[model samples]
Target: MARHIYVHNPFCARKCPYCDFYSVTDNFLCEEFYKAAIKETELIGSVITEDAGTNPLTDPDGKDTVYFGGGTPTVPDSRYICELLGAVRKAFNIASDAEITIEANPSSVTPEKLTEYRQAGFNRISLGVQSLDDEVLKTLGRLHDSKGAIEALKKISEAGFTNISSDLITGVPGETLDGIKRDIGTFKELGVKHISTYSLSIEEGTEFYRRYSGNIEDLVSPELERSMYHGTREYLQKLGYETYEISNSALPGYKSIHNSSYWNSCEYFAIGAGAHGFLNDLRYGHRDDVRAYIEEMNTVTYDTYKAFLEGNESFLKSLYVEERLTREDKMREVPFLRLRTTDGILLDEFKKVFGVEFEDVFADAVKTNLEKGLLERKERTLRLTRSGLDLANIVIEDFL
Candidate 1:
């Protein structure tokens, strides 16, 4: 009875230099990966059914969101995608109006493929446009240029998808405020309903880190980064896109339901290599190795799932690394997560879950930030002020 499900496809056409997500170039194993996903779904259904009466994570209703995130979910054959969706519906009770989304690269998807995907029950598409500049696209190792990205968006529209989201990155080497403005313009020109903007972070193993390790200022000045963020926020706001979450902006009624579930700290079921899930207060991740996943899942049988439900965690342990959250950890997580949204933290919900008043636990920190003009409290909600958003990580650290 998880409210959301995230299925990770661990294959990409080619790896982006700045990406650290688990993925491989192996397209040959797409069918095998889908099979593994189906098996995992069955295992989850068994676990939830057994614990339905007592598990806090299992809701009595049904799942309302399903996200096919990836290494490019569309890069594989569409038939596999359909099979996975079919297996998911069979394994869980899906709400009729559920939001089913898939992440795709501009170059990897075609109008015909998208039409097939739409037929398979995928109602939303998130394109990895990254940037609207050709040079920036090259710097980020994207396969499509600005023109190609726009054409893909056109085709997606032609394929009957109105809920389209574009992902863009800021603080790239040599990015300018004018460049960000142009990107936002491109999103509007393409009629995309949702936008997700992120600042570039040079991970240790990425090529960007290897090349520009200590010379980040040569990429984009810190002052310029700040200006670009504010500029993009202001411009998108003027264009009628609301910043519902720190990095997400959307037109009215176009917000990402799958992503909002995460910020709300809702329980979800995750499957496939490198996917993560939070259930019954335990957060867990699957093995990152694709071959290991396929081989292990091949050994799984119906009895194995039954064994897992009977307090035997050996099979589950072999497939995933699990962490059980403590009460303190859960409390610290709620405020920070809710603050990421425009609706902010709800006091009554916090009290219901933690059995204590919100102010009683965070009075000093809340008062300090409020005095500093970084946080604002409405009747039952508290959220970051405009000035606090860019430094959100810093403000949320107090809660942790």
Candidate 2:
């Protein structure tokens, strides 16, 4: 049972509109989160050991990847980053070449900070360079301007990070296919090894949703959105980038191992406020409230190992949402998640895990899609066609 690890840092300089992930604006209780994060890591370590029947201090199965995702991981002090990584290494058997990544905002990163981060064993850097156009960046409420993003990327490279990934967005109001192409070009020109381009979705409770809720036409039209998506795939493919996942393109071998773990539905450990984890067929999550996490972990009796040993469900319930996944639930997830990648689902692998033939399980769903040419089955793999990619959600829903 190889495991991936995720640690959430809830601090951010500010929240962007059209963003709904758990995060606290400004660096409030950041120090406290760091302390709690360490304790939570110990808790996960004990749980993994208990499940595997191994020593808690030394992980025998070893971690495949570790990711520090956030509100903005780069907003914290470098010492905090170093301490957290050190704690994870102490508690888990991290492989020598484990892909350790930290999400960074350009404005929050400096040359000195990059140096410290690299020295601290963060080999991959995912820069959130939303757009190259200043106006678009402003509309998105990002702290860094185009020049700042370029400078930060250069500093990251100069600091000796080769596995660099950048994030971009399409379907934003006032964005065009040409603009999307330019953004991708800018990332390539800057020598980014990987890029993740997302379609802008105006979720509820966000500033963008409040303003654009009634002004839907201001956003990119569905036809144009499809053009942008197709154009992105074509342009990136021409530039020697592989569209490994729906939103992610990578140059040769620069794919994000940490993220791939999630798409592959591998068991992983998660820590910090609003973090989620899956192991032993159960999913657990911390509440999105950072204050609750800090207050609870700041106590003298905050021994995560003790929490597990005593089966302290009351304390655990206060911190996390737990769910045991059902068989049907797992079956539906396998295809949906795997189809998001270029490799799609390996039929034999799926069968091995579920103890049933893939064809036998999804006969009707597969037959209908294959007839409609939305899906293809070549030997042992089942994948979505180019047209099918656009209607992925609708197609995947058949399984559910």
TM-score of each: 0.93, 0.93
- Where model 2 places Cα greater than 4 Å from the true spot, the runs are 50-63, 299-312
Pairs clashing in candidate 1? none
Global CA lDDT of candidate 1, please? Answer: 0.82
- What tens-digit string does per-residue lDDT give for candidate 1 at 34-119? 99889888776766663332223323233488899988998999989988987887677666788899999999998778999999
> Which whole-number lDDT from 0 to 100 does residue 281 have in model 2?
61
Residue-by-residue lDDT tens digits, candidate 2, 109-155: 99888999888889999999988889889889888899999999999
